[model samples]
Target: MCNARGDEAQAVARLGFLEWAFTEPGQVTAETVKDALRHPATKAPGSAAARAFVDYLRQAVTPLSAGRARRGRARALH
Candidate 1:
């Protein structure tokens, strides 16, 4: 049980690092990260990993959509 707990803690820490690393300068800006993830035009075709990074972005943005919805509701009430 202790080993499992340690593994879970390590996983959480790694995720936090990734979240910070992926964030853009001065903000948690995913668009900036997305732009950085793109391959150079000189490359004939982007790598499979680059395409996967973009797919991750699409999935990640869904939660942000709900945050926006909450903010809009707050504004409407004012």
Candidate 2:
């Protein structure tokens, strides 16, 4: 049952990504995320998953826009 649920969730996510890609081709580049995460520094201590999420977000949005979005997220967290 858990496996089935996970598969369904993954399918939904995949469809959503396809829609997003079609809507905004400029975002969601592997290079963008990689560069964003690697740039400035990588020394911030955290779980591997957190670091991975940062990289994923960087790649998932426009560079400038993502930076602004991240700032908002940071403020919200605080």
Candidate 3:
């Protein structure tokens, strides 16, 4: 009853996951995302959409971290 589609609990959990994507704790490492994926709430019915988003989030960070690492290595060369 919390929203038009109901399943308020799942919705709240999903919102938490989304918020984690941009928060300090969530940005730690791949393990953080993995833990979120393993969370029971993430497996709820509406999760079909979360897969792509999670994948995108996972993929999006790869290059950014890599680039930073690359720059750090380059700086060391100087």
Candidate 4:
């Protein structure tokens, strides 16, 4: 996910999210992700920019997560 557009703060946030998501089983909820985004350490670099970046990430990831959940359920039924 690293790219030129992603500055150090954004990279740190993303890494933190990944760590949180993988550290525990079933810990990747929207609320948890938002919590990580708003975390003091993660937001310390630049609150406004981090907030905006996280908002964008929320919009993009939420639907994909929902869709994945739905697909997992569908597969279970079959």
Candidate 5:
């Protein structure tokens, strides 16, 4: 029915917005991203893809202190 279709469309739009918030340069902070992940809109059944994207962002932004330390060691050797 038209109502079901409309709901699906709205869910898709919300997923797109969340994706942009997670991936776009400087659009959102890690805490904001976490909050968005917990939001009901993001938790909709149709939002699995968007949820995965935000999860990827969460892992990608994890502190890189170990990597930085290795880079510093390499630089010291140069």
Candidate 6:
């Protein structure tokens, strides 16, 4: 999923990102992905889901490090 999709543009972008990551591991972080991202399809979250999403975000931050890790779960919203 982190990699690009099947398209010339995406593949080119993916290759560039990969090269950057390899050459500059320190700089190529989550921010790199965030920076490359522009006007993501999903809208920003709001207070409507805060009660449930807050804690979920806190304890549910999964590391991007390579290794096996189970996904975290949040309390039921309802």
Error of 4 at 50 (Å): 4.8
lDDT of 5 by residue, 23-44 (tens): 7676577776676567675454
Per residue, candidate 6 scores C-alpha lDDT tens digits across 1-78 of 133233543455445445645786575555554443333321353333322232223322345653333322222332
| Per-model TM-score versus the true fold | 0.33, 0.31, 0.35, 0.36, 0.38, 0.29
Candidate of highest lDDT: 5
What is the Cα-based lDDT of residue 22 in candidate 6?
72
Question: How much is the lDDT of residue 73 in candidate 3?
Answer: 94
Off by over 4 Å in 5: 1-19, 22-27, 41-48, 67-72, 75-78
CA lDDT, candidate 5, residue 28 = 77
lDDT of 4: 0.59
Query: What is the lDDT of every predicted structure here?
Result: 0.49, 0.52, 0.56, 0.59, 0.60, 0.40
Give lDDT tens digits, candidate 2, residues 1-78.
Answer: 112234454554456446645675476576654554565544462434434434444546644447888999999999
lDDT of 3 by residue, 1-78 (tens): 133233544465467556766675524577666665666644643443454445544553564548888889999998
Could you give candidate 1's per-residue lDDT for residues 1-78 as a string of tens digits?
112234454554356446745664676566654554454631332444333434444454445458788899999999
RMSD of each: 9.3, 16.3, 8.3, 7.6, 8.2, 13.8
Which parts of model 1 are misplaced by more than 4 Å? 1-23, 29-45, 64-78
Candidate 6's TM-score: 0.29
- Model 4 stretches with alpha carbons more than 4 Å out: 1-6, 27-53, 64-78
Model 2 error, position 68 (Å): 40
Query: What lDDT does model 5 reach?
Result: 0.60
List candidate 2 stretches off by more than 4 Å: 1-4, 25-28, 31-78
Name the TM-score of candidate 5.
Answer: 0.38
